[model samples]
Target chain A: MFQIIKNEWRFLVRSRLLIAISIAFVSILLLSIFLGNYQTQKQEQTYQKATEHLRQQWVSIDAMNPHSAAHYGTYVFKPANLLSNLDEGVNSVTGNVLRVEGHVQNEIVHSEASQMQAVSRFGKLKSALLLQYIVPLLLIFLAFNTISSEKQSGRLKLLVLQGAKPLEIILSKTLSVWLYGVLLLIFVVVVYGILNFQNLTAEILTRTGLFFLSYALYYFIISGLTVFLSARWQNATLALTSMLGIWILWTIFLPNILMSSAEKWYPLPSRNEFQSAMTEDRSKGLDGHNPSDERGIALEEKVLKEYGVDSLSQLPINFDGMRMQADEEYGNSVWDKHYGSNRNILHQQKKSFQLGGIINPFIALQNTSMGFMASDNLHHQDFLLQVENYRRVFIKMLNDKQTFGGSKTGNWGWKIDNAFFKSVPDFEHRPTQISVVLSNYIMDVSLLILWSIVVIALIFFGTKKIKIV
Target chain B: MIQTIELTKKYGDFTALDKLNLSIKEGEIFGLLGANGAGKSTAINMLLGFLNPDSGKVQINDIDATKNAKDARKIIGYIPENVNLYPYLSGVENLDYFCRLAGLKYSKTELQDFLASCGLQSEANDQKVSAYSKGMRQKVGIAIAYAKKAKVYLLDEPASGLDPLASKELSILLKKLASEGATILMASHDIFRVREVCNRIGILKSGILVKELYAKDVSANELETLYLKFMQN
Candidate 1:
C-alpha cells in the first residue's frame, strides 16, 4: 500500500500541470490565512478600544440618581478568539456589541455582514471558505480520474495481473489523494500558527487540532467517494461529471436549501410581534412609571400593612425604589419567556441543519468547525446569556442603593457619588470552555464520523464490483 | 503451467467463450489465432482472472485461478494490446512501480539492466513513456515482466501496433523468456508472427478450438491458409 501511494505521489509530482496547481493552491491558501489574520487583529483592536472606553466612562460617572445611572447603561464587546480567524462561522453575521441597561433588554447590533454591501453574497475569501469549498473540489478533481484512467487505458488488468486486489488499488489511490489534501491543510494551519504565535493558548491549539481532524475526515470522504465513483463508472468523463455534480450539490445547493427549510420549520416571531407581546404581558403586571397601576397599588397596600403603617410616610425605605425593583423582576421574567423561546427556536433550527449532515457531510464539517472555534450560534447565545446575567447584577445593585440610601418614596433627586458607581464591578466575558462547547456539537461530530465510516465501507465493498476487463 | 476447463462466458444472449478447454505446459509458447469476436481475448481475460467464467475453471501453476485469483495471478505477467502506461512517468519509473506491485525490489542499475535486456534503449529509459512509441511501451511491459520474474506471460495482440522490426524483436524476446522456462500464452491476428515464435498454435472459431498444430510441421503460408479457412467457416 505504501509503495502504491509512493508511486502515485511520484506520478502526480512528475506532471507539470499538477505541480503548477500545487503552487497556485498553496499561494491562495497562504493569502487567505494572511487576510483572515489581518481581519481578526483589526477586530481585536476595535473590541479592546471599545471595552476600555466603556470602562472609563463607567468609573468616571458624575454624582447622580442611582436609577438614572442604571438607565445610562454601558456596552460589552464580544471577545475575538484566535480560531475565529480561521472559521469565523456565524460571527460575521451575528452582532458583537451588546448594550446592557435597566428596565429593557437590548439586542446585539452592528454586525459586519449588515455593514457590507449586498454584492458580498459569497463572502470574503477566508481559510474556512477554501478548506470547506475549494479544497474538497480540488480533491474531487484529483480523484475523479484515479481509477477510471487506469481502466480506460487498459492498465487496470495489468495491475490486477500483478497480484493487486481491486480493493487494495482503490484504497491506496484514495489515501494518496487524501494525504495530499491533509498536507495542504497542515500547511495552512502551520502558517496560521506562525502568524498568530502571540495569541496562542491551549484552547486555541486544541480547537485548531480538532479543526484539522474534522477537515481530514471530510477530505477522506471526498477522495474515497470520488475514487469509488471512478471505479464504478466505465467512462472517465461520466465519472468526473458525476463527482463534480455531487460536489456542487454538497457544498452549494444542499446547505442553502436545508437552511431555508430549517427556518421554515422553526420560524422566529417578527420583532414587532415580540415587542408587543412583552408590552402586553408587562402591562398586566406593575408599570414602574405608573404607581397607580392596579398591581402596584396592591403591592403598596401589602407593604404598608406588613410594616403596620396606614400611610406611605410611615415606611422606613423608599417604596419608589422597591416598586422599581419589582417592575424589573417582572420584566426579567418576560424577557426570559420570549428570549428563551427564540433561543429554543434557534436551537431547533441548528439541529435541523445538523441533521442534513447525514446526507451531506460538508454540513457536518461546517458546524463542527464553527462549534470548535467558538463562533457558532450556540457560542454567541452563551455570550448573550453571560452579558444578561451581568446586566441583572449591575442593575440590582443600583436599585438596592436607591431604596436604602436615606431616600424617600417621592424624592426623585436622590443621587449616588462616583465612588459608588466605581464600586459596581465591570462586565467581563469569559468564553465557554471547550468541553461545554463540544457538547453542543455532539450531533455534528457524530454525523461526521458516521459519514466517514459509511463512505469507507462503501469504498471497500464497492471495489468488489469493479470489472478489471 | 496454465490450463482452462470448460471455460464459458456470456454477455446477455451472446456466448463470448463457449465451454473452451486449453492447456499450455511449462517452457512452451502457445499462440491463439482467431478472428475478432472469436473469444480469444475473453479466454485470456479468464486466464488472468479478470472475468469470471459462467461454468468453468482456470488453473495457473495448478492453482484454481477463479477461486483464488490473487494467488493465481502472482506468477502471471500480462501485456495488453495497447500497452498503456502512466504517461507522466518515465519508462524506468513505470517498470519500478510494477516491480514493486509484484513484491520485487531492485536497484536502479538492475532495473535499467532489465529494460536493456528487453530492447528498450537506455536513452528512452529516463524519458517519459508519453514520448515513447508503442514499441517502446511494449519493451517497458517486457521489462516489467522480466523484473517480476513471472512464470507465466499473457500477451493480447502484443504486436498489433508495432512496426515489423519491433514485432520481430518482441517475438525474439518472448522466445528468450520461454527458453528461460516461462509459459507463454499469446492471442493475436498475426498468423505470421505466431508461426515465427509459437511452439504450438490453436485456431479458435466461434468460441471453439477448431484446429491445433505444431509450428514445426507447417509453414507461415500454410498456417495462414488454414486460419483463413477456419475463420470463414
Candidate 2:
C-alpha cells in the first residue's frame, strides 16, 4: 500500500499541472498569512491608541463624585488572538471593543463606531477561508479522476492484472491526494509558526494542532469520497462532474441553507425589540435617580428605619449611593434575563447548524476550525461575559465607595481621589481552555471522525462493485 | 495454466458468451479469433475474473479464478489493446510503479533492463510516456508483465495498433514468455498474426466457440478461410 502511495506521489509530482498548482497554492498561503498578520497588527495599533486616549482621559480627571466617574465608564478592547491570523472567524464582524458603563450594561453596537476601523471586514483574505474552501476543492480535483481515468483509459485492468487490488488502488490514490492537501496545510501552518515564533504559546500550538487535524479530516473525507466515486463511475466525465457538483453542494449551498434554516427555526429578537423589553423591565424597577418614587420611597423608609434616623440629614452614609447600587443590581438582573435568552437562541441556531455536519461535514470543519482558533462565537460570548462581569465589579466599587466613604446623603459635592478611581483592576479576556472547548465541541469533532470512517467504509464496499473494464 | 469450463456470460437478454470450455497449459499460446461481437472479449474477461460467468469455472493454475480473483490475478498479466499508463511518468517509471504494486521491487538499473529486454529503447526509458509512441507504450506494458514474471499472460488485441515491426516484436516477446513456461492467451481478429503467434487458435461466433484449429496443422490462408466460413455461417 505504501509502495502504491509512493508511486502515486511520484506520478503526481511529475504532473506539470500539479506542480504549477502547488507552487501557486504555497504562494497564496504565504500571502494570506502575511496579510492576516498585517491586518492584526493594524487593528492592534488602532485599539492601543483608543485605549490610551480613554485611559489618559480617566486619569487626568480632577476629583469628582465616583458615581459621575462611573458614568464615564471605560471600554474593554478585545485583543486579537495570536492564532487569529489563521482564522479570525466571527471576530471581524462581531465587533471587538465593548463599552462598559455604569448605567448601560453594554452598548455593543457603539463599540463598532468608536473603536473598530473595520480593518478585517473589507474583503478579508483569511487563511482559514482558503484552507476551508479551496483546499478541499483542490483535493476533489486531484482525486475525482484517480480511478475513472484508469477505467476510461483501460489501465485499471492492467494495474489489477499486475496484482493491485481495486480497493488498494483507490485508497492509495486517495491518500496521495489527501497527503498533498495535508502538505499544503502544514506549509501554511509552519510558515505561520515561523513568522510568529516569538508569540507562540502552548495554547496557540494546541489550537494550531487542532486546526490542522480538522482540515486534514476534511481532506481525507473529500479525497476518499471523490476517489470512491471515481472508481464507482465508469465514465471519467461523470465522476468528475458528480464530485464537482457534490463539492458545490457541500461547501457552498448546504452551509447557507443550513444557516438560514437554523436562523429561521430559532429566531432571535430584533435589536430594537430586545432593547425595548429590557427597558420596560428596567422601568419596572426602582429608579435610583428618583428616590421619591414608590419603590425608592419604600427602600428609603426601610433604610431610614434600620439606621434609626427620621431624616436624611441624620444619616451617616450616603443614601444616594445605596439607591444607585440597588438600581444597578436590578439592571443586572434585567440584562441577564434578556442577554441570556438571546444567547440561548444563538446556541440553538449553532446546534442546528452543527447538526448539518452529519450530512455535510463542511459545517463541522468550519465550526471546529474557528473553535480551535479562539475566534468562534462561543469564545466571543465568553469575552462579552468577562467584560460584563468586570463592569459589574467596577460599578459596584464606585457605588460602595460613595456609600461608605464618609459621604452624606445629599453630598453631590462629595468627591473621590484619582488613586481610588485608578484602583479598579484591568479587564483581561480569559481564554476558554482547550479541554473545555473540546468538550463543548464534542459533536463537531465526532461527526468529522464519523464522516472519515463512513467514507472509508464506502470506499471499501465501493471497490467491490466498481467497474473494472 | 488457464482453464475455463462451460464459461458463459450475458448482458441483459444478449448472451455475450455461450457455454464454452478451453484449456491452455504452461509453455503454450492459445489464440481466440473472432469478429467484434463474437464474445472473444467476453471470454477473456470471464477468464480474467473481470466479468462473472452465468455458469462456468475459471481456474488460473491451482487457484479458482472465480472465487479468489485477487490471488489468481497475482500470477496473471494483461496487456490491453491500448495499454494506457500514467501519461506523466516515464516508460521505465510506469513499469516500475505497476511492478511495485505487484509487490515486486526493482532497482533503477534492473528496471531499465526489463524495459530494455522488452525492446524499449534505453534512451526513451526516462522520457515521459506522453511522448512515447503507441509501440513504445506497448513495449513498456509488455515489460511490466515481463518484470512481474506473470505466469499467465492475457493479451487482448495486443498487436492491433502496433506497427509491423512492433507487432513482430510483441509476437517474439510472447513466444519468449511462453518458452519460459508461461501460459499466453491472445484474443485478436488478425488471423495472420494469430497464426504466427499462437500454437492453437479458436474461432468464436455470436457468443459461441464455432471452430478450433491447431496452428501447426493449418496454414495462415487456411485459417483465414476457416474463420471467414465460420463467420458467414
User: Using DockQ as the measure, which candidate wins?
Assistant: 1
DockQ score for model 1: 0.81
- Give each model a TM-score: 0.96, 0.95
Regions more than 4 Å wrong, model 1: A118-120, A306-310
lDDT of 1 by residue, A302-340 (tens): 999998998878888888888888889999999999999
lDDT by residue for model 2 over A32-96, one digit each (tens)?
99999988888788878888788777777778898998888888888767788999888777777
List, residue by residue over B89-187, the lDDT tens digit for candidate 1. Answer: 899989988888888889999999999999998999899898999999999998888888889999999999899999989999999999999999999
Clashing pairs in 2: none
lDDT tens string, model 2, B1-233?
A: 99998888988899988888889999999999999988888888877888888898999999999898878888888888988888888887888888887888899999999998889889999999999988889889888888988899988898898899989988898888899999999999999999999998999899888888789999999998899988887
Each candidate structure's count of clashing pairs: 0, 0
The worst-scoring run of ten residues by lDDT in candidate 1 chain A lies at: A117-126
